[model samples]
Target chain A: MTFPMGLAGPISGLVCGVLFGYVLQRGGLGNGCRLTAQLRLQDWTVFNVMFTAILVSAGGLYVLELAGVMHAADIFIPTTFLWATLLGGVLIGVGMAIGGYCPGTSVVGAAAGRIDGIVFFAGLIIGVVAFAGIYTPITPLLGAAAGPQAQTLGDLLGLPAWAVLAILTGVAAGVWWFTRRSAASPAITCAD
Target chain B: MMKQRPIWNSHAAGAVLGLVLLLTFVLTGHGLGASGAPTAIAAAAANVVAPAATQANDYLGWMVEGGRNPLNSWITWEVIGVALGALAAAWWSGHLRVRLEGPPRANNSGRLALALAGGILSGFGARVSAGCTSGLGLSGSATLATAGFVFLIGFFGAGVLTGLLTRRMWK
Candidate 1:
């Protein structure tokens, strides 16, 4: 039997967004402090959740594709633009630290009744407007880094997808183990 | 009399999120996103306010092509669902409160201004990168996309550096 059995696209997106949003809100990840804490090396919760989610989904998707249960090519893989991605990411990250919310968490934070989230969202709108105004000038840099290549980790590393997945999963497991052990200490626990 | 947890356990919450992502892929041949919703809305607004200018801009033009309503996109509706879901979660956990959050030293006005500035930066960045954390970093990385991984690194690295530099903002 097919999984996700006959659900329409919009309905599926709705259900998925709801579930994803709920998890983010409930996990205290909707808070900017908790997320930033990961960077401070104080709290491992964010790292734990993020890596785990990535590993699980990555592994799951691979397995499903291998089993012929899912068509991997149908997935919406974003194109690569080395310069644009790096520049945009750095800016977004800095904004997250300053504002205490990324685009996604900011949305959730606003929903959770944080006034700051609303303000942050307003800034996001303005930022988009500014970008649009200057789009002509930046278009070349933004869209011209490299080939809009659809390469994967395996392709870059010259390894099989499964191999890369296994390595990533191992790394995640190691981080989890270390973080858990460190968290058990009274001092470290307080830091978190 | 009782201390309430912030929300749910991270692992449990993450597992649910993973399952949802998996389900999304299975059904829609795609994944969840957040920032694109607003971009589309903003594009539509530009189209209405300044159709000529919107048409002149390559990015906005792409969004307005086919005479499709930007608000009619999947990302827009899903973002609505996100707000609703977060509200539900917050309400259930009794964490729904209205207040400005900032470092004790910063005034509400300043905090609000900074928040707005940060949001603007993030929104622009999302547009430049073609996705935010969820769409690019999470979804893209999950699929092992090279651009996604690069974005992830840049995003997190810049975040840490900025967070440390602006530690006073949240203190």
Candidate 2:
């Protein structure tokens, strides 16, 4: 079932993107205050939403693969780069803490008519340009730091895909339970 | 005045989002993304300014390979859909307010400045990590990729530390 990238690709992309953005907006991810509150540990909405999403998707992917609808190996698996990922993660985390919006969330923010969201999006483009300008020099560094090109956690852990997913789901469930109990406390504030 | 609608439950929204993500994979053979569109746009702009240099570069070159229109990409159209979808959501929920967002203690200009700086950092970071929250975090993690988990820990850990340092901005 090779989905040709002629006319149907962009249409499907648009439809999926719409659903993706709509769900994220309904989840309150477009709000900067809510995002910042998550980082401060004063709100658990981000965690709750993201953890549940990860669990559901991870489970669904494995199940669908089992049903022979798709092969998990056929999906795109980004290569691991320990150093670059760490550095990039730190920068992104700092940005999220200060700006309160990731690239995806920024679009939602701008659409919601927030001035900061628009500004943040402008800055994102600038950053992209900056990175591209230095790509020639940075490629070697990134290439060298790229780690094992494993397919999935199942490959790395010597377990089946379903087994890895089940273990991860259990861990996520445990964390979710803890987060709910914590949310019940007076730790959160009226940020929004 | 329009009555404002509260957001949906986090769990429910997450479930729906997960399904949407799975649908994207089944339909498109890849997961959703946000940063790729901007990157493509940047490549296109660069091509306009310096076609030779753009074609020679390692990153932007691939986007404009063989004089192709970078904007003629699925990711670009998908992002356009994101904007419209968000617009509809905002309109329906009465959240379409034209104002700067942050804590009351932070002024509008200050918030905008921080937002810009943060965006720059995230933009650069996303390129370095090869994806944003959707492409890498959600999609990668969904496929059980190890890089996704590593990136998640890095961002979350760093985010918590930075948040603690910037408490006054929100407080």
Candidate 3:
């Protein structure tokens, strides 16, 4: 209810994190090959899982916001820094391809006793420290273009949030449909 | 020594994860995150070791000002939970194993080195962009934040390109 802090926060977070991690491992995302299969265009499982989650949560949040049950404004919607988003995304993407796991997956993999995951996590700590050490020089660029405005996909596209969500969901569904059909065809081996 | 069943159906798992994200927002008014917790921890540690230097640093200073134990963070707990849950699932599924993942051609040392480099880059990127894949890509996108969309585009776009470049790794 009220934001988690102190004992309650850590307990709740631990429970949630465990569930989240369990789901990730169960989804085969803990496996590097299954995740990188997306890059090979040989598997659509990653895309399917990602967009499906997006669609469900997007729709769910919209409904919650509309019902006034959840104050969407309370959530920390990050400000848009065009350059940071683009640069950060590219860096993370490259890392995922090379490392075979993103931050979350790396954690899950580590729990499953994957040596690579542990190493990656150690790197993550080092990276954070490195960023801190260089914060003065990079502060401007890192925080650049971060206006306090709460813009969304709808605002950027000049459409209603629900409408955009609907359109996006439809597109995602179409992709899923096509991927399913292709995967089912005898010729394709559908990697994991 | 035995074949493993395919992990839960992707669609089903995605739906569950989506609902979890939605619940997180509904209950706490925040999305799931993984990187910030560690950063905060690092900041707190820095503060203890070198209070003046930590205070002087722009990033660590912001974290220290937030007024709470660095470890007492929502993301921190969620991450801990993630590890527990993952272990449980692995145990149940009989897929739990201690091993390094890499192309059969790669050695353990090489794989470990790459993992470290990748982690560093990913962590820095998450901080710069303000969130990691889950926090920014999933949570942010669900919220329809503009930054989220930009991040999604940048991450996936670069992913495809990089994947192409490293085609041999997977093959």
Compared with the true structure, model 1 gives a TM-score of: 0.91
Candidate 3, residue A187: Cα displacement in angstroms equals 11
Across residues A78-177, which tens digit of lDDT does each residue of candidate 3 receive? 6688888878888888888888778888888888878998888877777788888887898779767774587888888899988999888898988887
Please list the Cα RMSD from the true structure of every candidate, rounded to 1 decimal place: 2.9, 2.2, 3.1
Error of 2 at A159 (Å): 2.0
lDDT of 1 at A62: 89
Q: Can you write out model 2's per-residue Cα lDDT over B1-171, one digit (the tens) per residue?
A: 356887887789888888888778777667888988888888898999999988998888888898799898888888888888988888887777787886567787888789999999999998988888888888888888888888888889999999888887665
Residue pairs with backbone overlap in model 3: A13-B77, A17-B81, A17-B82, A18-B81, A18-B82, A18-B85
User: How high is the CA lDDT of each candidate model?
Assistant: 0.78, 0.81, 0.78
Per-candidate TM-score, chain A: 0.86, 0.87, 0.85
Give DockQ per model, in order.
0.64, 0.69, 0.63
Off by over 4 Å in 1: A1-9, A181-192, B1-5
Candidate 2 error regions (>4 Å): A1-8, A181-192
